[model samples]
Target chain A: MMRLITSGAGALLGGLMMLAGVTGPAAAQGTGSATLDAVKTRGQVLCGMSGSVPGFSLPDSQGVMRGLDADTCRAVTAAALGDAAKVKFVATTTQNRFTALQSGEVDMLSRSTTWTLGREGNLGLMFAWVNYYDGTGFLVKKSSGVKAAKEMDGATICVQPGTSTELAINDYYRLNKMKFTPILIQDQAEIQGAFLSGRCDAYSTDASALATFRFSQGPKADELLLLPDIISKEPLGAVVRKGDDKWFDVVRWTFAAMITAEEKGITQANVESFLTSTDPDIRRLLGIEGDMGKALGLDNKWAFNVIKAVGNLGEMWDRNITPMGVPRGINNLWTKGGLQYAPPLR
Target chain B: MADTHADPRMSSARSSPKRSMSFAWSDPAFRAIVWQVLIVGVVVGVIWYLISNTANNLAARRIATGFGFMDRIAGIPIGESMIPYNPAEHTYGRALLIGVLNTLKVAVIGVVLATLLGTVIGIGRLSKNWLVAKITAFYVETIRDIPLLLQLLFWYTLLQGLPSPKQALRIGDAVFLTNRGLKLPLLVWEWQHTMVLATLAVGLVGVFLWSKHAKQRQDATGVRPATWPIGCGLLIALPAIVGIVLGAPLEIELPVLRGFNFQGGLTISPEYFALLLGLVVYTAGYIAEIVRSGIEAVARGQWEAAGALGLRSGMVLRLIVLPQALRVIIPPMTSQYLNLTKNSSLAVAIGFQDIVSIANTTLNQTGQAIEGIAVIMAVYLTISLSISLFMNWYNAHIALVER
Candidate 1:
C-alpha cells in the first residue's frame, strides 16, 4: 500500500515535470517574448516583490499596494498591457526570490534586489535598469557616545542575513580594521527588534532602508542617527530572466521612458498636453509621430500610456518614498544634478 | 458413500490450480510489482519531461546550467566561522565547508546540553511535588507553543539589549555580558596537557571495562557491588594523578576588559546563543512528552513485582522500569535529536552562519543554486543518518531477551 501511494505521487510529479518541460523554455524568455505573448493572451503581468518594505512595497492607508517598487510594477503593466492595474504582485523573500523568478512564478522582480555580475550570470536573470542607488550605513543611538562607524570598535552591530548588507558590513569592518561583533538576524522585523531593544549597539543596512525604518519608528525617530558612512554601492534594479533580449529591451526602455518623461516635464497630468505639443522629441517619446514602440513589438503609445498611468519617475518616487523622508539626492534627474539620464526616444 | 466423497475431492483438487492461476492479479506480490512499475515509469517520464523543459527554458533564456560556478571567488565575507575563510581567496566550496563546521559545532553542543536539560525536565514533569511538575509542564508548554523563529528573535533582541562593552555587566574579574556577546575565560593550553588528555581517554576506557566486569561479577555471584566509586577513581583520579606527575596540565586564561571589550577570551556571540537556546527549549517540550508517555507505558505490574521482590524505589526504577521504558524512548528520542539538527537550519534567520546561511551566500555569490542546495541537504542527511544509526545500535543492545 505504501509503495502504491509513493508510486502514485511519483507519477503525478512526473506528469507535472513533463508539462513544465514543454512550457519552461518559452517561459524563461520572459514576458517580452513567448512568455510576454502568453501573458498578453492571458492578460496580466506577473510581478514579484517584497510586501513588507514600508516605503518600497507596502500597502497604503487605503489598503492598496502603494510603494516605489509597487509603482514600478504598475508602470510596466501600464506600458505593456495598457492598464496600470494589470499586474499580479507575488510577495517574495530573499530566500525564494531567484527560484521564484527562475521557475517562472513571476515575470519580473521589482524587489529591492541588488544587481551584481554574479546574480546576472548565475541566477539566469538580467537586470533591466537600476531604479535605486543605495549604500550601506549604520544607525546608532545618540546616547551610545559613538558619532561614526569608525568609533564602533568592538560594538555589537545588528544586521539582516542573506542580503548584500551582510557582505557590506564585513567589508567595512575589515577595511577599517574595526573589531565589532555582529548580531545576525534573518528578517527585517528581528533586525528592528534587536536594534530597538538596545541589543545591538548599532544597526546597519542600506541608507534608504535605514531612513525608512527611522521614519517608521514614530516618536523614537529623533533618538537615533544614521552615520555618514556609505560602505558599499548597492544598485537595486528590476530584473527579468536571462536570454530574452526582446523582453529585456521592453522592460529597460519602459524605465527609460518614465525617466525621459520626467526630464521633458511630462507629468501624468500633462502627458496629454505633450501629445499635442509641436516639440519633436516629446512627439517621438509620446509615440505621436514615431514608430519606436513598434520596433520593440509594443504599441506606439506605450510610453504615453505609461506616463499617463504611473506618472514620471520623479512623481513615482515622491508619491511612494518622499513621505518616508528619503531625500531625492542621487535619484533625481540629471537636469537636477542627479544621475538619472534617459536615452533619446528618437 | 466413501467412493462418492473421494471422487468429488479429486475433482475439486484438479481444478484448484486453475482457479488460483486466474486469481494471480489479486496476489499482493503481483499487485505490488505492477504498482511499482507503473509508478516508477510515470515518475521517470515526468522527470525526463521536466528536465528537458528546464533545459529548453535555460537554452532559450541563455542561462547556463552547471556547477562550474562553485570555482569562482565568493567575494563575500562570512561573519563567524570555525575555520578562517576569506571570500576573495577561498572558493565557494571552502566557504561552504566552513559553514558546515560551524553548524556541526553548534549541533554537537546543543544535542548534548538539550538532552541533559530535557531529561531533567522530563523527570521533573513526573515529580511528586505539584509545584515542580506544574512548572516543568508550564516551561514545556510555553516554549513549545511559540514558534522557534520568534523565540530566536526574542533571545537575539534580549542579548543585544545588553549594555555596551564599555559598560558591560561584569561578574567579579572574569565573566562579562555586553551587547557584543558573553565572554568567559579561555583555557591556556600547556605542553603537559597532552599527557593529561591521554590519561583521561585511557581512564575512560578503563572505567567502561571495569563497569562491565563488575556487572558480570555481580550477575554471576549474586553479590551487588558499587561501580560508581571504582569508575570515578579510574576516570577522574587517574587523570588528576597524571596531571600532577606532569606538573599541572593547563592554566586558566582569565578574560580581562581590555581597551574596549575583553581582549583574551572565548566569546559566545549573541546569534549562536539565541539559535541554540531557541532550538533546545523548543525541542525539549516534545522530548518531555515522549518521556512522559514512555514512562507511563511501562506496565504498573512490573513496578509492583519489583517492589514485592524487596527492590527499593530507586533500584526498581533503575533495574526494571528504566530498562523497559528505554525500549519505547530510544526511537522517538532519535527523532527529536534529528528535529533539533534540522531546526538548526533556522540559525540562518538569526545570523549564526550555519551551513544553510553560508550555502545561501555562496549560491548568491557563485550563482550555483543546485550545487549549494545539494551540499546543504547532503550535510543534513548525513548528520541525520549517523545519529539514527548510533541510536539504533543503542536500542538493539537494550532490546528484550525472552526465554
Candidate 2:
C-alpha cells in the first residue's frame, strides 16, 4: 500500500513537471507476420488505392479499377490468390492511407505513393518496389508566362497537404531564397478547382499526376504547361504493413516478375506460348525448372499467374500511362536506359 | 417467566441458522455494497483489458509509445503563425505550440466579436420596427439551420472566387481584398512600443482600482459620482499622451501590390479568415437566442417600477433589466464560448493549421498516433478547463447574495 501511494505521488509530480514530455521511446512497429496466412484464408486481398488520381488509381464508369497503380494490386492478388479478380479495392486519401494500412483495413496500398525515409523509419510500413519514378514539378497556365519554377517566385501555389508535395515546395523556395505563398488544401479535387479558377498561380505536385490532371481536368491540353524543372525526387511505389516478411516477399517478387517478364519479352498474350521456350531463364521464371515459389511458400505457378494477370511492366504502362501523355521516360526497364531493373529469376 | 419472555426473539433467530448464512442477500445495505463492488470490478477489468491490448498492439507494430518525438524537427511549413516558426529550424513541439496559439487567436477574437454581434441581433429581434425584427429572425433561422462545415466551405469557396491580387478590390491604398487574403496596414513594432503597451496595462489597472474606490464612497455617502468619463480618460487618453511623448513608436506599414501578390502589410490568409468568419457567424446565432431569452427572463415588474420612478426606457433597461438579465445570460453564454472554441478544430477542413490539424500532420508524418492524440487532447482539455474556471468565477461574482 505504501509503495502504491509513493508511486502514484511520483507520477503526479512527474506529470506536472513534464506535462508535454511522454515517457518511453516510440515503438516503430507494424502488423503481425500472420498477414500472409490471413490473406490466404480470407480468400480475397484488400488493396488500397487513391480513388481520384487519373492514370494512377481511378475507377471507370463501370466501377472497375483501372490504372497503372491498380495493376500492381491485381498482380499481388494474382500471385497470392492465383486469380486477379480476387481483390477488393479500398479508396484511400493521403491523410488516412497509412492509418488504413496499419489498422488492417487494407492488405496492401498501391496508390502511386512516394517512398520516403521518414515514412520507412516511423510509419511501420515497407515499400515493395518502385513502380514509377516521379519528381515534383509545377503546372501553370501557359498564358501566365511563367516559363520555369524559378520564375514562380512570389506566386501562390496550391498543393494537397499531408503529402511530400507540401514539403518539396517549401524546400525549393527556401533554397532559392524566394518567397511563395502556399495554398494548402486537403482534397485533390479542391486543389484543382482552386487552380482552375485562378485562385492559385500554379499547381505543384508529382510530374505524372500533373500530366494526368492537365489531360483529364484542364480546359485544353495546350493551355497548361508542365514546367521543365523537376524539383524533388519522388519514387512512387507499392507499400505494405511492416513485420510480415513473407507477405512483403510475395509482393516484392511479384513486382520483380513483372519487370523480369518485360525484360524477357513476355507479354500477357505471349506468356502461355513462352512456356515451351528452351531458354533456362524463361523456364526458371515460368516455374518449369525451379523451386522459387516453394521458397516463398507459394505454388510453383505464382510468377506465371502474375505475368498473365497484368502482363509485363511495359504492357501495364502502355495500357494506363502512355495514353495519358506520361512517357515511360525513367520508368522503363534498365536495359532500355531506365531504372526498372529486376534481379535474375534464378 | 421473565426468561421465557426474552427468549422468543432469540429462539426464532436460533431456529433460522440457515437464513443467517444468506443474511447478505436479505440485508439491503449488504446487497447494495455487493452490487457496487460487482459494477466497479467489471469496469476496472474492461479498462485493464483495453490498456493491455493497446500496449500489445503498439509493441507488435514497433510503434513507440512516448512524447520523445516532440523534439524532432518538423519539416512541413506553416503558412502563418502568431509565434516565430521556421519549418527547418523549429521542433515539432514548437510547431504544435504555434498551432495552439493560432487556435487561441481565432477563439479569443471570435468569442468577442460573436458576443457583440449576438447582443445587437438579440436586441434587434425585440425591436419595435417590424423590418428590423423580421430581418434579425431570418438571419438567426437561416444561419442556425445550416451546418457549420457547409458554411465554412461556402465562405472558403467564395473567398477563393474573388479577384486576383493584381486586380484586387481596394479601399484607398492601405487595404486590399483579394483571393489570397485581406491585406491591411500593420502596426510596425519597435522596442519602445512594448513599454507604451505596458504603461497602458498599468493605466487600466489604475482605472479599475479607482472605480472600486468610487463604489465604496458612493455606498458610504449615498451619493454616486460619474466614473465612466474619468475611467476612459485614465485608460485611453493617458496612454495616448504617453505614447506620443515616447516618440510615437507605433508606425503604420502599408501594403503594396507586388509582382504576383501584395507585400509589406499583414496578410490574413483566406483559410484563417474563412474559419474565423464561420465560427463567429455560426456561434452568434445560438448566442443571440440565449441573449434574447436572458433579456426576456428579467421581471417585467422591475422595468415598470423603474419607469414609475421616472426613469427613461433606456435608463430602466440599464438600471433594472440589464443587470438582472446578465445573471441569466452569462452561464449559457459561457457554454456558447466553449462551443466556439471546440468548433474551431474544424479549421482542419478548410486547411487552417489549428492545433488539431497540425498534430494530425505530425502524427501522420511521425506515425506516433498515441502521442499525437494525447497532445491534442491535453491542449483542448487545458483550454476548456481554463474557460470553465474563469466563467465559473464570473458567474459566482455576479450571483445574487440575499444576506
Top model number, DockQ: 1
Model 2 agreement with the true structure over A45-142: per-residue lDDT tens digits: 99988878888888899988889889999999998889999989987767667766776668899987899998887777899999899999999988
**Quality of candidate 1's docking, in CAPRI categories?**
acceptable
* Candidate 1 ranges beyond 4 A from true positions: A1-32, A177-180, B1-37, B69-71, B140-144, B219-232, B248-250, B258-260
Could you give candidate 1's per-residue lDDT for residues A44-86 as a string of tens digits?
A: 9989887778888887778788788899899888877889888
- In angstroms, the error of model 2 at A88 is 1.2
Q: What's the count of clashing pairs in each model shown?
A: 11, 9
- List-wise, what DockQ does each model earn? 0.36, 0.28
Question: Model 1 chain B: which ten-residue window has the lowest total lDDT?
Answer: B14-23
Candidate 2 lDDT over B87-200, as tens digits, reads 878899998999899999999999999999999999899899999999999999999999998898889899988888878999999999999899999999986777778878
Where does the lowest 10-residue lDDT sum fall in candidate 2 chain B?
Answer: B15-24
Query: Against the true structure, candidate 1 has what lDDT?
Result: 0.79
